[model samples]
Target: MKKITVKITSILIALAMVFTFVPASVVATEDVTEQTEQQEQVEEVVTEEEVVTEEEVVTEEEVVTEEEVVTEEEVVTEEEATTEEESTETVVFDDINHWAKDQILKMHAKGVVLGDDQGKFNPNNNITRAEFTAMVNRVFGFVAQAELSFTDVQGDEWYAEDLAKAVAAGYIDGYPDGTMLPNNYITRQEAAKIVVEVFGFADMSAVEGNEFADFAYVGEWAQNYVAIAKEKSYVKGYEDGTFKPQSNIRRGETVQMLVNSTGEIITEAGTYTEDFATNVVVRSADVVLEDLTIEGDLYLAPGVGEGEVVLENVVVEGTTFVAANANLAGEFATVVVNAPVAVNIVEQASITNFVVNNKAAGANITAIAAMVFEPKAAVKVNGQDVVAGSKVTVSGGGETVVEPPSSQDPIVEEEHSVYEFSFELPTEIVAEEDVEVAVTFAATEVKDLGYENVRFAFAVATDVEDAEVTFTAVDSEGTEYTFTNEGAWGPAAGFAIPADYTAATDWTLNFSKAGTYTITFQLVTVDGEVLVEGTQEVVVLEEATIVEEHSVYEFSFELPTEIVAEEDVEVAVTFAATEVKDLGYENVRFVFAVATDVEDAEVTFTAVDSEGTEYTFTNEGAWGPAAGFAIPADYTAATDWTLNFSKAGTYTITFQLVTVDGEVLVEGTQEVVVLEEATEEVIEEETTEETTEEV
Candidate 1:
């Protein structure tokens, strides 16, 4: 993003340079020089006063006196002539101290307004409609001329091109009778209407009450525009509290109104790093803007075709218009459609309010992620009201999800067969830890009622890269099923729930990093038709303490790194006797726990001592005989264990030393791989060899 500090003065300078006009001060200086030369000639005439006395004797006393009076009259007349000459040579307005003097001069320097051929700027004179149109056209750079058909505006008229441009720009229109009174003086209200239209300020025309004492006298057609102009400070009421809207507007007043409504027009492709005190028109694309505050409306003009405009850390205090087929990225206050163009709200971009006006009936707004609309935000299309949570396709992202306002819960339409659906997740959990989420589902009327494929589908989306989710459910026959997805939607097959089931609860989520996550679930049919769906959010907090630092004791263990599925493999886990005695407890127990990612997978550990005694335990709990395999605390030798896996997947085995009070003194985890069951051919070969040996 390019950074440029553009002051309001710099904008005026740029505008002046664009039009190649002489400054009003320079014009004033030339007028002063001419006046000074005239004064020197007057002085030279005064030096000739002695010659009058030298010629006194040529005539009688009365004649000499009459000549003297004539000479004095001539001197006064010459002075008057010099004053007139000075006025004619003055290129600036006579009202140098006028209230709108600065604006008028600036407008003149920008070539938006001009003085007469006699070098007189009649500041207080009424401005004609043609003149106002020309000023507005120049201010907005509206050069595209429309074909004129007005009876009074011929092609050869001085204001013909300007009227054509204003008409083309859709700001000014002729009378319905096909006549444009070009030379007629435009009223204040009429100029206000044109100013509003030229600046695309119609959205702000909604006013609360009459702000002017004479507002009732304002033309009905121009009332709203007058209100908007007053609200925007482009026009003001008199000190007497009346907006003389019916009175013809003066040329200086017109300049002030136009200047108030003017803004910077960005015509080139580059970054703009200046805070704009007024509106900004983006006429070019491939522009990056940053760290700037725009106090007025922003226009993504139609000239920016198919190009991308990026706004970073930019704040717009007024409505924004997307009139181009452009990609926008960054934050915006309010965005409205002006053209029927496809607007891509790329990643990281957000719009506070989005409006699709009648002129942009088919405007397309697409976003990379779900666009959440504020509750108070107005989103309308072709004058029809559209609520928040309207589905929008998520390109280059996950499933399309529309988050409703937080004040209301998402209402599942009654048309969906599975009416009761909810996702219960912990609002906050420690990161790098496993957490359980409860899922409930019930169908009012199940489609394909007896189908076994009818199940629940779930998806987990998070900023954390290593986040994972597991779905577990139990059937009517006590058969447990589990499914796990790495980062996205789980199990293309989904988790099958019994047809008679209601509110099945066991689901698990694990986060490897601290972040926010969204969990979405849907009751899907056999053919993947979503019956009902809901989404919930969870916040994962960073772990307060590391596991190792919190452990009371430290120990090491060993187990089989790999094993075959459905097979019993002999494995031994050894813990140092000295480390156990260090606990100084008369009685303690050995704890083993196992968990895996395989669907419906289970692990069992059977302890075998030197005396050939065997004890069995499942990977269900920790610390006691009822929870896990317990070993005698006095045992000073290593214990051997047999492990068996029901399915092929990655498994985690945890070894812990704990007291009878169930306090773990030490704990460690080791990863184990459960490979697929041995091939049937190997078993057949072994059987054939045994049969042959017996034969």
Candidate 2:
């Protein structure tokens, strides 16, 4: 079943020229970067060499089985049949040789634009602001962020949502008076800003010389944007040296500009050797290539010419586009597709992928020899899959899929599950705010805990005044567990688990007021023994602001960003306030959260008074929240907390000012640099210096 269709022999032996036509003036060239973004690379990593052997044609006995012919109507749904018929219809326009013909037609086929009803694409007509916004919306796949409120734009207007979307995306704006001149033609400078914003190129700061004679006429706000557009070749000056920033852009020129800014064209009849270059567009010409290698993208414009475009020994490194055009009616078949646009990939050619829009146009891709669709690639014709090494013939009528010789293995994906115990809590919260905490108990695989009546408890270690904790709900074994609060608000509360449950459970908690709270959860058996425990920290801020500077409780110090190890460092935390009475609360509790970014670094904090007196700081609270003494109310206080590091690296010590009830009013972090431990020789020298000084 995987063997190549016997047609390969006949196809390789015969090479045909499908048509003959003259060249058109439609020339398009897009840069590699723009096209590459749309392309999905198919990574081909072949570790084992594949062997190919010649196949001998053998005479087979006919089985005499009747062949069945299935009509499209019989197999496809009515809606699908209607859609197919509409997509294959022909699209013809009066303007054929215009420079923007290919771009306009391509966009039309893709339903990005539509010309007038007279089948005439008045390319020279000025494009209105509303029309341009609609086109941008289609081209960039923008959705309505909100309804337009502009006075000139009605709610039911077709372009209203598009205008709103453009504005919401911050790529365009309305006039100062909350009006958007939807009917007025957008000026060149205005369009430049929108284009630059859409492309995210607004930060190009280096200014270039005035590229146009009327540069002085350019507004100050748009000067930088205009310069960048010109510098990137998105816009060009006229022959008179004036940019005409106020000039209205014509429809044809606008299409050309949009296409040129994003893609490239190949008009000359020669091989394109630009490897890895993207956005290569071939339109309205009979082109021949010799050993072409493209790593970006290749676009074939629809109905541009009648001649065959031949690629010899071609290698497509990106997604190749066979049909890239659209019409104004938003119809798939917007252009009148003429003679078959035959793309002959010579024997031994390979394509990473190919895409064809059957609704607008089609291509005849003749694979003289073996053609490969690299692994992970997406190759489709008329919404159908084209197997690799298969000769695909797609016309305006239908598509044909030729089977390949060897079968490809279907890609299989592996799903890996990981176990992690985590909780979601706000890092910072205002004081007196009600907070809900969620904790997740998770495991990678199915597990059963053969236990009954397990007790779950959530505990707070920090002493917080007026703070209340309550268990909200617990979910386990596809059921919810409810617990009642018994006025046991401060320290800990427990919930009873039913029998025969799974390993994971979700717990919800509610807390009142603001404070530095050390939270711990424990899973215990009914026998009062703790099975597992976990801990986390939370800090709360005061809601009210201090009116006077003297009432502000503040802390400040110049903390080093980094340090080397083995070096003696001076560490001090300054505490300041206006007056003794300014300390609004009875006590200003200092809490230290010990943390470090350095691996295996030894850290010790020793509190010292200004008179060289040492005081001990207790870690009475739970881990991550070490409670210190209240600041002396006399006013400005400086407590030197000497920090000692064993290993050289960077570390951070966070200081929190919490209420006696456990609410954190203010907090600050100091980063210290700990260098690599001092070398033995340096340590000996320092020791010798101390001894010599003493003598």
Candidate 3:
């Protein structure tokens, strides 16, 4: 925990909620057997807030450089060095502006390490993990390393990979033998050092946070790493600010560290909280990082693939882009990117660290909260560059037409009203650094925070695909937080969601603030227009407080189908109050037939359910439309449960329903079901199924 490399706040975790085709606010946890047929639920009162945010930096295209995509064949092959190659590789080189030649030139051109003809940048030579570890620490601005792992590193043993990644993720420990042989090739042990630094995040947001036992022994070589990490607040220490430096970090520990680093910090190992996260349907190109928590609800869209769903909190770590497609663990949520985070890249993994160049696969704004950082436009902390995939929940958008919020502006105070506004921020900025942002939400007449909804938005450009957009929440103390997410959105569009996992990025973020404060966002564009364009306003009259279970509306409507009955006609009774996002439609029951005969005519149907058993449709429309009340294909031929008109008298069918949250949308009979005639065979079968004949 010395320099901040293994802390949880610096990582991005995976999505917290189990993804489904249901609405974002609620998730369905049941034995869901059906996987086909997507049904749309009508939202009655959803306010389409056009939240367009302006940015502080130049256009995204200018702020970042797009990495040119290359295939394996395009890369310099391992074919034996030609005579011309050796001659080229032997050219004299200089340090400052090395006149690179031969293998060095090939490596440099292919995005590898650099050296010169005179002082040869041995591009074709084998490198060590230890070296990679060291380089990673340097590139990512890991707190200067103060400790070594085993004695071998300190011995005349070289660790190229370890050196690169260690420097990138920011920490390194020597071997049992006491000497760091800078020139010797490294082994797997050396490479793991860097990998562990980027993956061992522990969520530290809770009052009683996680504690590392090695808090006592500060390794002789790892001391510098421990100090800087602790100072930056990325790495935490015991109450005494001491960390266990000599312990060998584990692989799982690596996963844990990297995840915690991106955003959240946990104090306890087995402590888990169950929170409801809502997956919002995005109409805009840019996704606000904060909105998509590591713990989220269900996403109601129908899609597949990585690009279809945008990962909100994924981070990129490492000194170089290794293979361009590697994984990083985040706090509560994690995501995969198509580039190597130069600081977190593993050196020991490859002999020639420059063999493969890494870069992102571009990003798509028309995605599910897609986050993309323009190429090369990364924010730096203490001079160390935050990897390209780090999440920054910037809130500013494009310049707002509304005047900035100032006391001078007309103070439109109301008895109880809701206000709204929109603004923008840049994708690249320093953490814990309060940026001067501007927004103008309407001064609401509603004063209660319970009723008024506050929304924040950011934008991304369509052309910027394969780039990473990050969102992190930093607390006032400069500590980042954690989210528990699966990090996978259903596949539909061009992008494919990575397998669910936990990862993190290097940034200070936290969403657990005590009181009301202003927020900001970064705006992006698609087809040249602002990508996520729109606006809304909110007033934080009070802190965000938890509310009791309740329903906003209690109502019903006529089904979209006809209610008349000659034969067993299908008549649906809608018990939803259009504005219902939850509770308004759940656990309802209804019978189909003439008023009195309703109970006599047995009928059943099948449909998709979203909220699961949390609620049930007793009669019909109980647990939403997908529950049971659907028309059975075998009964009513409009093909389902047919209602037979035996005597053609006044008859009606009724329905009853309720929500798992305890709200009832419908529990009355529609009196709409009228049966005309049952087929002769059906009548005979019914008679035979329930008859006792006399001789």
Candidate 4:
């Protein structure tokens, strides 16, 4: 009995040691199994060892139970339980199993929408006007604020700032009663209008016919908006084919509409060819969208950092907001905003209304063509205020300079008298040739006390290189002043005009290349005070049909000084060519033109032959000959042309030889006088009597 009791005590001690060393997590299962087997063995040992006391056994049992309790408690401490719970937590909405569940979840993930404390997305609940505005503001990232005068809105309200942003963005407005019913549920038609305005779809023309059964029930003001939204696929009607315009829009429906409007978020850079049915957000740069259309707005997100996005033959049916620091090229319809970056409107690119938002303060916008701005848009180009709805002309690839509009009641300085200044140019001239320009300066109202020794100055400005201007003026005292200038806006030449003077001067302008040139003239006092100024434009061409002189060849024509009307006269024409080194002339031809006072009269040059082949000439001095008449390199006389005069008037005929390249070789004009038949008869009788007297 003593041995059995000792063995049972040793076994109990071993069991206690095993329980203490085991890990807490495995303690419960292993302890139960080991305790049962030991209990059975202990009972057998206890029966043999009657010396073992019930009190000792009970004490051991209590000790084992306390150890088990401590191990279980350690396995699941307060910190561990909290960590486990957090690991399984997720965003869950119990009521999002509806049609817009995906969209609602998407918006919730973006933190653009939220649920109640119970994690229930009550998508069927009506959305208020203020609530919708907040959603739109978040989507567009609009932070701009506007002054609010709504009677119902308090500055401290939750939606006050968002409503202000929407108003400033020109997408929301208050009622005529000066109250913005922020808490009121927005109807379908009203929501549609807001969506349309937010995307700049207000200018979109409505479809020819409505597809909704309740279309007529839509408010007249919101009808077009609803139609545009539906056409853009931003909104849809119910299953019953009726758009309940007056029905309040639910949260799920609002999310769906917003999602539909912002169709795709393009994050990768590539050339996209697929057309977007709705709005598109470009978050990456170097994206070229070609031959495609975006039915809704296009947003150049801020992620497009200092790169280029080209829109080649791409049409955006809605507004394009350029918020990225990127270069936009190619062609598109209109652009609303370009904040914090320079916008270069390249050549052949046009925009209908380039609205510069307030955020683009001090941003430089360069355009080759004229840009029209919004009426209330406050923007400055080259330190000049851009007037609303006015076209601002910008120089290509240079700083844009805008001229501010003159005030309605401008104060005119009384220091100098107002004068009418005008200049005349040929409007067109040939390059490398000199053309005459006439200028006139006259007072609109002559002052009795005319200022004496008024200085007249002329300046020439051109876009072409190496252009020149030269002229000579003689004053009343016969003092001649000659001046010449080269290049753009060179030094001006000045001369004095007498009092009560209406001065006119002629200047010769020559340009080395084909381009447009401007000649400006000014009348000022001897002290350099400008009285009047004017400018005129002249176009220089590469080739011209009518010119005063020839560089390659010279031509002359001889006709009867006087010929009787209804009679045929012979004209002898000759051409002489000069040697021009390095200029290999080819395909040289002879042509002539005739001008008369008779309207719609046909002048024909016919060779004096039985065939009577008529030569035709174009207004541009191009001719068609019966046979190609190539002019020889030397002085040559080939044709004796006969002309008939139907009317007794002085006629001028121009003869010229031009090359195939439209270069004039020889050009000259001569006049012929035609007498009436009765006058010729009287002259003939007088001539016969004079001859008899001489015999």
Instruction: Compare the candidates by lDDT and give the number of the best one.
Output: 4
Q: How well does model 2 score by local distance difference test? A: 0.47
> How do the predictions measure up, each by TM-score?
0.39, 0.29, 0.17, 0.39
Q: Mind sharing the TM-score for model 1?
A: 0.39
Once fitted onto the true fold, the runs of candidate 1 whose alpha carbons sit more than 4 angstroms away are 1-97, 108-111, 114-121, 203-205, 263-270, 282-287, 301-310, 324-327, 340-344, 361-366, 372-695
Q: What's the lDDT for candidate 4?
A: 0.58
Task: Give the per-residue lDDT of model 1 (tens digit) for 44-71.
Answer: 2222332333223322222211111112
Ranking, lDDT, top scorer first: 4, 1, 2, 3
Model 3, span 562-651: residue lDDT tens = 233334333333433323332322233333222454444433333332433333222233333434343221211111232334343354
Candidate 1 collision pairs? none
lDDT of each: 0.57, 0.47, 0.28, 0.58
What is candidate 4's lDDT per residue for 133-174, written digit by digit as tens? 777666655655766645567578767777677666667656
RMSD of each: 27.8, 29.2, 33.7, 31.6
